[model samples]
Target chain A: MSGLKNGILVAALLALGACTGNPWDDAAGVGGPGAAGLGAGSALDPQSPAYFQQEVGDRVLFAVDQSSLSEAAKSTLVGQARWLTANPDFIVTIQGHADEQGTREYNLALGARRANAAREFLISQGIAGSRLKVVSFGKERPVEICSNEACYAQNRRAVTVLAGGLTG
Target chain B: MRTYLASLAIGAALVGAAFMATAQTAAAQDGPLRIEITDGVIEPLPYAVPDFVAETPAAAELAREMSRVIAADLSGTGLFREIPASAQIAKINNFDAPISFPDWKAINAQALITGGLSVNGNRVTVRFRGYDVFAERELGTGLQFSGTTDGWRRMAHKVADVIYSRITGESGYFDSRVVFVSESGPKNDRRKRLAIMDYDGANVQYLTNSAAIVLAPRFSPTGDRVLYTSYESGVPQIYVLDVGSVQRRVLSTDEGIMSFAPRFAPDGRTVVYSQAQGGNTDIYTLNIETGQRQRLTSAPSIETAPSFSPDGRQIVFESDRSGAPQLYVMAATGGEARRISFGSGRYGTPVWSPRGDLVAFTKQNKGRFHIGVMRLDGSEERLLTASFLDEGPTWSPNGRVIMFTRETRGENGRALLYSVDISGRNLKPVRTPDGASDPAWSPLQK
Candidate 1:
């Protein structure tokens, strides 16, 4: 069942890539298309961290004071789980975050819940629990700096940060 | 008038009477000089503190500085207004001289503080007195304190505490310390270090370096040790540090579990804190010496920020069992809890006042945050301040004042320590070397 889901996910990604002509175009927001300068091993490479972070979406956003995964967030996590399965040598740390709308202690716990939610989803997708670790930054780290819902929506997120290399 | 004269004679003869006894006598008289703090909309009692008399040449500067600190301490409460020396109708050149009632009354000074300072090599002695200027009598017995020259500020605070206690019939918070997380850098990558300072933000001493992230430094009941959460081990863990030695050790817990929001019980032997495991959080009490842990709350919702009541028999904490964070009170050992906050928005960081009658907390409502206080039964909820982000309130040793963190809005937002009276007045910023938050006030110094 898991293999069949991956096959269809890969087929959909390839069809989407063919339509865009450049698979790296969707990642322009990270730092333009070829910023990594890796050439053949650049963000254009499907297995690269840049591709996972940008094209496949490394982070899932949450609503204000919420930790339950949204449908959009689940879709992104499914892609993340597929990539993790393909790259078994990479150990990923799921970082949960919250907006500045809550207390310091509550936000810390909320961030943990969000990160755990993402971790559980990946585990359900057959990723080994040992290959994943979770941390909650709470509201300490934010990708954006505004005070409105726009910035808050971005801050309340769980990002899968990949660590270690293909040592195996 | 007869009772006032009799108490005045006792105050003069027993110059060393316990402050509580003297204050009680004055309070029993129901003198016009009393400032009823519970009464709303108080007109600040105008008072004067002329430069203390310098008996020795080396004491001149110290005398002047101490007098200024005393005046600042009294006026900072917003209950007392200092009448500047420039407006004083009389000069207090001699500490033992009879107070010129007519001169003080002419300047509308309702109360007066006069003192003398003497320095002998490294030793310094300060003697001070408070007077009901309009009554033409001393407010309390004169008192003297002796300490080393390096401890002049503490001696000054002692004087102010005595004056405050005498006038208001309540213990003073001036002679206390606060341990807090001092922050530097930007919003995302802030560097935090544990720092301790005088309650008035003087004599700051960094307890830890900014090498790791630290949050919520809480002072022990005796103020000699600090409890806080540090990420030095790559995860949140509770640590206790001796303020005098600056040495610390992590509290052992089940591996991989996160612990934060630690508070020392009044007995200083046990700590009530929040522990998270398996994506669920709950409150737990730990015996610091024995390493024994007891689960306090088994709710599926988040339960953290537990504060012990002054008597140590009860604990007040924040929980989201009702779907949004609110204040709840339970036995120190924990079981069933009664919700103490029924407000519209979320409430968190509930700190029981040292007085044990009120609990201070951070409230968020309608997109604005407030530092508020509510009674034990969840009645008489009063919001003291409103801002973009205001949370984590710590009470003064006296419980009359609350110090909390207030963060600005937007990209350049920074957290700063601010304080307000429980009556919702005299909101002011506490000076720090840089951005600061999560203030935990220590009990009055011994």
Candidate 2:
């Protein structure tokens, strides 16, 4: 009976796969409405979330599983902080991610530490604490799906996403 | 061996008229009949379970299905082998047929199980008896179970449990459930939701949608509630979800704090998890009823993944205070901690077994991950599996097997659930729709 069920499931998956688009291409940009720019709008305003994500760089990569910011990561966060301060109408959430190297719970904790580290730096640079929220996806979501160190380095990252709405 | 005499009382009502004595019965009365399984390497005991006799026309198909389920449950344990019905020389068409002992013993069948089923309206009843072919006598008294038709599978499991316990002197794990993270979409932006299913990967039910990311769901001692970390509030906070109603409330209600890796204590009323404050992570406990909280660890470094001992006297957790992630043992109240892992690799996610003897964890060394077990003091460490990524192990109800997540590396890397025996044999994959990770096995069914 299990074999019969598995056979049907495989057939259904094959049928679905034929019509589905590449998931990686669809998930390339940052999350949220205007930030994704997938099908939201074609116009690129100087102050739009898409412009901030594409032009100002929405993410910063970390080393392995360490949450401590390196020189290059700090430089990227400085640019992100500057962009957020200029675009005062937008609220941002920092999404922390880790490479698939550690355990699930540990990666979650490590991701939290990384996001909090970035949030503190943004706050130190005079961003309001309420404007910046934090969440950690751990290793559940990875941009580069390879196992080698090259792809893992890209997976360990924290992205700042614009809320794209008016907020006090 | 201890036998249930009450089973004899039940047998008198169900098996007396059907009891069959053969020519070897006189010789069987002079010797004891039993089978004991103590080592890993041994031939599985051979048993026969003919299709049950259906008493009513409405029970014809159900009787056969239930018999198949019971056979699969026993054989899947790798401790028993079922002889195909084609090898049978006799057919049991009546519930109370007289002796046919020679027919079964001819096939070298050491054990034989015979049963009958009856369905009346919405209620179903199954009666079964086990026989020792070598002894040429009934192994145990007959037993019967009556339940609603919807619980037919459970009734089959109950029969298998009885047979397993009577023969091996160990409890059965067939009647349990596992909660895990069901993954879909692409690897870069996977959508995860909590799902529950039978131990054999049947009857799956989703507990939550994939609108928000959820992780590390731990079942309560009674299996009524689950403790997990969700990002629904824009930050990771511990949430307690009721399994029956699909309703949930945030347990880590503290403002401006992120909590993850929540686990229920043996008492089920309290929870222990990690909370990050001021860029520092530490372990904390909360009472679900009173809302009281206690700080369990205050190290400057990170400490998380806290699991309680069966007696609730101690907690085994992972900490990086020693310059690397390692296992630690500390009292429940929190004080000085003793490091338990000194191996070459980094270790995390130390879960204490229900039997209170070994701790299962994931170790990383030489760029390879492994699922391994160790004694309470961290001595006698044994690695069970090695792969690109293997982590987050949960023990079977009997503590004989360990289930963990394994992910293949590449552009199409995906996470899947796998299990292995603690003795490092019988490693196998657990089936699920799409991808799965972070499995939490539930206690035996009610």
TM-scores of chain A across candidates: 0.74, 0.72
User: Least accurate stretch of 10 residues (summed lDDT) in model 2 chain A?
Assistant: A18-27
Among all candidates shown, the one with the greatest lDDT: 1
TM-score of model 2 vs. true structure: 0.86
Q: Please, what is the TM-score per model?
A: 0.89, 0.86
Q: How large is the C-alpha RMSD of every model relative to the true structure?
A: 7.6, 7.7
Candidate 2 per-residue lDDT, tens place, A1-168, comes to 243543443344344432213111113343322333455545668576656665566777788768888887677778778878898877777877898888887887788778888888888888899898786777866656667786677678887867755431
Residue by residue across B130-243, what tens digits does model 1's lDDT show? 888877777767889999999999999999988887666577899999999999876655779999999999999999998778999999889999999988776689999999
Q: Give residue B160's error in model 1 in angstroms.
A: 0.5
DockQ (C-alpha based) per candidate is 0.32, 0.41
Each model's lDDT: 0.83, 0.80
| Quality of model 1 by C-alpha lDDT | 0.83
Residue by residue across B258-316, what tens digits does model 2's lDDT show? Answer: 89999999999989999987667899999989999999998888899999999999999
DockQ of candidate 1 is 0.32
